[model samples]
Target chain A: MRIAFAGNPNSGKTTMYNALTGRSEKVGNWGGVTVGSKEYPIKEEYTGGKEVVAVDLPGAYSMSPFTPEEGITSEYVRTANPDAIVNIVDATNLSRSLFFTTQLLELGIPVVVALNKSDINEKEGTKIDVKKLSEKLKCPVFETTSTEGKGLKDVISNAIELVGGGQSAPYVQADINLQNKAEVDAEDRKRFSFVNDIVANVEKREMLSSETTKSDKLDGVLTNPIAGILVFAAVMWAVFWVSQAWLGPLVADWLVGWIETFQEWVAGKLENSPAILSALLADGIVGGVGAVVGFLPLVMVMYFLIALLEDCGYMARVSAVMDPIFKRVGLSGKSVIPVVIGTGCGIPAIMACRTIRDERERRATSMLATFIPCGAKIPVIALFAGAFFAGAGWVSTLSYFFGLLLIFLGALLIKYITGYKYRKSFFIMELPKWKMPSLKFAFKSMMERAKAYIIKAATIILICNTVVQIMQTFDWHFNVVEEGAENTSILASIASPFAILLIPLGFGVWQLAAAAITGFIAKENVVGTLAVVYGLTAFIDVDELEMTGGANNVAMATGLTSVTALAYLFFNLYTPPCFAAIGAMNSEMKSRAWLWGAIGLQLGTGYTVAFLIHQFGTLFTEGHFGNAFIPGLIAVAIMATAVILIGRKTRAHFDEKYRLHRDGKSGAAA
Target chain B: MLLNAEPGKTYTVKEINTDDEEMNSFLFRLGCYVGEPITLISKKKKSCIVAIKDGRYNLDELLSSAIIV
Candidate 1:
């Protein structure tokens, strides 16, 4: 039997599904976190070993879908013949949530309404007469706290028992012309009145929502236009500083020591083996994977902090705070969610844009959100920052700030190029009550993300490192390249041409080019490939580097000055994300033109940003632009011209659209 | 009047003036419609926090202005 979990947004449907199914799907305080339907078998404990599948659908307000994700829910419930429905309603907001509940009850599916967030209601001195509510709605109602795993078993068991028993709606709309807007509106008003009547009878509240509360006071400080932006900046900077500089490196040193010891043990075991075999197993695979995994502490810590932020309901406030500023650039404040989520991973971030009502804004957000460097790129940032800048905290902090700057600039550029005219776009976001962020949930989220990071390091990064190891070991004639003749190796020969194109960016060597190329497969591959090619693995521990003639030796091997290194880091950060994230962008944008334009914009931004940094840095330090300045200038000029041409065409199209309006008005004026 | 209403004051919504049909319908679902009591919880330079039914929502200037009290 398949049971559908439906509810209003943020009413804990996904949270309940995760608890029942033992799956860690994303759960945030904000609405529209789950954009698609997900299903898994219920845990044995919950079902008592019954063969039941729980379908977790996105939250919907009513049968008539308003947003894109809400449509997913309404469509599934209406068409998909589920045996039972579990409507998870926010208990505190009973008056508003049951507006959708009545609609769900009318669907004729056996609905067992799970009044979720009952703990909140209990704290606020709100009481609901569950028996009366159930009697009135003609369904079984059980109080539940999905976050605490309370009342879940009863809800599921009740739902399972009613699998074949059909539902009977208490209040049904009279037959009317569904196509007539006025008729539908009138019917909806009646349905709401019915829900209101039921709520007034069953729900007793001690505190009215209209009264000012402590959270409201916090909002006054955190959501103030000036103070909020500064607080946001400070919070982000602290997240990076703690993760990258203070706590992360302290933990990473210990982890790297263990990794080095393990690598040494493996090398000792392979001492009697053939040179190629030993190098392949010990130095190539373990060394490369270890290099990538050494940054796990940083990634995990950042994930934990972000999860706490997401759990505490700050994201919705952040969106509300940013909406006014974002509106100026043809995007909504809701776009900020995707960009912040993009910091962890771009795939879900792009998908998160589904909540935005405007199609153009949604697509534009999906295309640009990846500018915020994700977890995969952290290793690269750490590696470069440590090697070139002595692990300065400002390096990582500056990268994130630069990313935000680019997002703003990119939005403005897109606004002009798309010929967007300022129209009145209304912004409304629910203010979910703030609570103490759950530490256990943040720990679980961090562990889930860390596990994924390690698996990728073992699988894709491991495979890429091995391939690079073999390719660099052999020549075109299928013979191992002679020592001191590494330039003739297969990998070197292929990467040489790409190196020439990067000459103007100051780092033109085939090794840097090779790392950049492999970066496309997975951003972590940049660090892995660099470790393999350089035969160095202690990128995190300063003590190890000191014994090996210090960080300057690693920097010297890469043959890049601090200026060029910063340029290269920015290049990798701003360019299009890994192909997997690009596929996500493709799916979210749902337009070939937008996808191609996104890629073009990313590439241009990466190159132009890097070129300016390297050239200007060299000019400031060495009194001249770096080599290949003229060619880089021509390339940037060509990109600039293309942008201008596209903008002009868009403007022409805009004028043409308005010209028709003027033509119609010409008659009135005459 | 929602645009200029003092904080902590309740006013009944008389109309939603936007020509956008979708916006009107969405507001209706949130229980922000004619005759519903709406409270102006707080006001900002560009947006206002409003309490409708049992939920608190932050609405921008344009949206709050459209909701005539």
Candidate 2:
């Protein structure tokens, strides 16, 4: 039997679903976190012995959908033939929630109203007489706090028992023309009045929702245009600092020690094996994968912090704070959520774009969101910071600061290129009441992400590392290349051409080029392949680097100056994310032209930024331009020319369209 | 008018004047239609936080101006 969970956005549907199904699907304090439907078998504890599957649908305000995700929810409950529907209602907002509840009750499917977030209502001195509400709605109603796992079993069991029992809606709309707006509006108003009448009968409140509350006072400060932006910057900086420079490295030092011991044990075991076999096993697999995995603590900590931030209802306020600035660039406050999520990972970040109402803004957000360095790029950032910059906090700080700057510039460029003119863009976001962020949820989220990180390290990064190691070891003739003759190896031969184009960016060696190319497969591969090619496994141990003076050794092994190393770091950080992220961009963009344009913009931006950094840093430090400056300038010039040409063509097209529209209007008047 | 409404005071929504039909109906579903009470909790330079029914929403100036209170 299938029991579908449906409700208004942020009404704890996913939380209840996660509790019943024991599945850690994304649950955030904001709405539209679940853009797609998910089905998982109910846990044995919830089901007793009956086999039940819970279909967790995206939240919808009504059966008549507003957003795409809302459409998914309404369509699923209508057509999917679910045996029962569990309409999770926010008890705090009974008047608004019951509008959808009534619609759900009319579907003939049995609906057990889960009065979720009743705990919030209780704290606010609000009371909903459950028996009275159930009697009025003619359905079973249970008070549930999905966060604490309260009353879930009762809700689930009641839903299961009513699997095949048909529902009878308490208030039904009068027969009216479905196509007429007036009829629909009049009927909807009547239905709302019915819901309001029930609310008036069943709910008693000591505090009105509209009265000024503590949360509103807090919002006054946090959503201030000037103070809010600074607070946002400081909060983001604190997250990065704690995860990268302070707490993260402190934990990583211990983890890297264990990883190094394991690497040594593997090497000890392979002592009797052939040199080729030993290198492939000990250095290629264990060393390379371990180097990537060593940064797991950093990424996990970041995920935990981000999850907490998402849980605390601050993101909605941040969006409201950023809407004006984002609007100036042709995006809206809704675009802020995706970029914030992008800091955790790009795929879900891009997926979050579905909540955005504007198509152009959504696509632009998906394309530009990845400019914020994600969890995968943490290893790359840490490696460069440790090796060249002595693990400076400014390195990571500058990376994210530049990332945001690039996103702003990129959005503006896209706005101009796409010829998006000023339109009346409406910004409205529900400010979910703030509560203490759950550490349990944060820990669960951290573990989920950690598991993904390890699996990715074991599979994609391992394969790429092994391939890189083998290619660097053997020449075109399939013979092992001797020391100092590594240029003859297959990897060198393949990466050399790309290296020529990267000469002006400094660090134009085939090894660095190969790492950058493999980064396209997965961003972590940059660290893994770097470890494989350089035969270094100690990228995460900054304390060891300092104590043993090994930081200089690692930097020397890569044969890059500090200036060039910073350039290379920027190159990897700003370029297109992994292929999976590109696939997400493609799906969100849904336009081949836009997809190609996004990739071109990212590539040009990365190259141009790196080239300028290298050239200017060289001039400042050594009093000369970086290598191949003329060629790099030509390349940047070509890209700039292409962008300008596209912008001009787009402007001309808009003008022509505008002229034609005006002419047609005048002609009609004539 | 919603834009000039005093904070901490409740007023009934007179109308929503946006041309966008979907946004209009969406707001209607949230109990922000004509004669529904909306309370302005706070107002900022660019946006204002309002309470419609039991939910608080931050609306930009443009959207706030469109809601005739």
Measured by lDDT, the strongest candidate is 2
DockQ values of all predictions: 0.84, 0.92
Query: The CA-based lDDT of model 1 is what?
Result: 0.90
Question: Which segments of candidate 1 are over 4 A away from where they belong?
Answer: A542-550, A651-670
After best superposition, candidate 2 residue A39: deviation in angstroms?
0.9
In candidate 1, position A574 carries an lDDT of 96
Task: Provide the TM-score of chain B versus the true chain B for each model in turn.
Answer: 0.95, 0.95
lDDT of 1 by residue, A1-670 (tens): 9999999899999999999999999999988889999999999898888989999998887878888999999999999999999999999899889988888878888999999999999999999999999999999999999999999999999999988888999889889999999999899999989989999999999999889887888887777899988899888898999888888878887898889899999999999999998888888999999989999999999999999999999998899889998988889989999989988998999999999998889988998899999999999998988889888888999999899889888888888787766466889999888878999999999999999999999999999999999999999999988899999999999999999989999889898899999999999999999988988886886454222343566698898899999999999999999999999999888999889989999999999999999999999999999989999999999999998898888677776766687773322110
Per-residue lDDT of model 2, residues A1-670, tens digit only: 9999999999998999999888899999988889999999999888898999999989889988877778899899889999999999999999999999999999999999999998998888999999999999999999999998999999988998888889999988788999999999999999999999999999999998978988789998989999999999999999999999889888998999899989999999999999999999999999999999999999999999999999999999899999999998889899999999998999999999988888889889999999999999999999889888888889999999899889999999998887765567899999998989999999999999999999999899899999999999999999999999999999999999999889989978999999999999999999999889989887866465342454666788898999999999999999899999999999878999889999999999999999999999999999999899999999999999999999888777776776687774322110
Model 2 residue A51 CA deviation in Å: 1.7
Which CAPRI quality tier does the interface of model 1 achieve? high
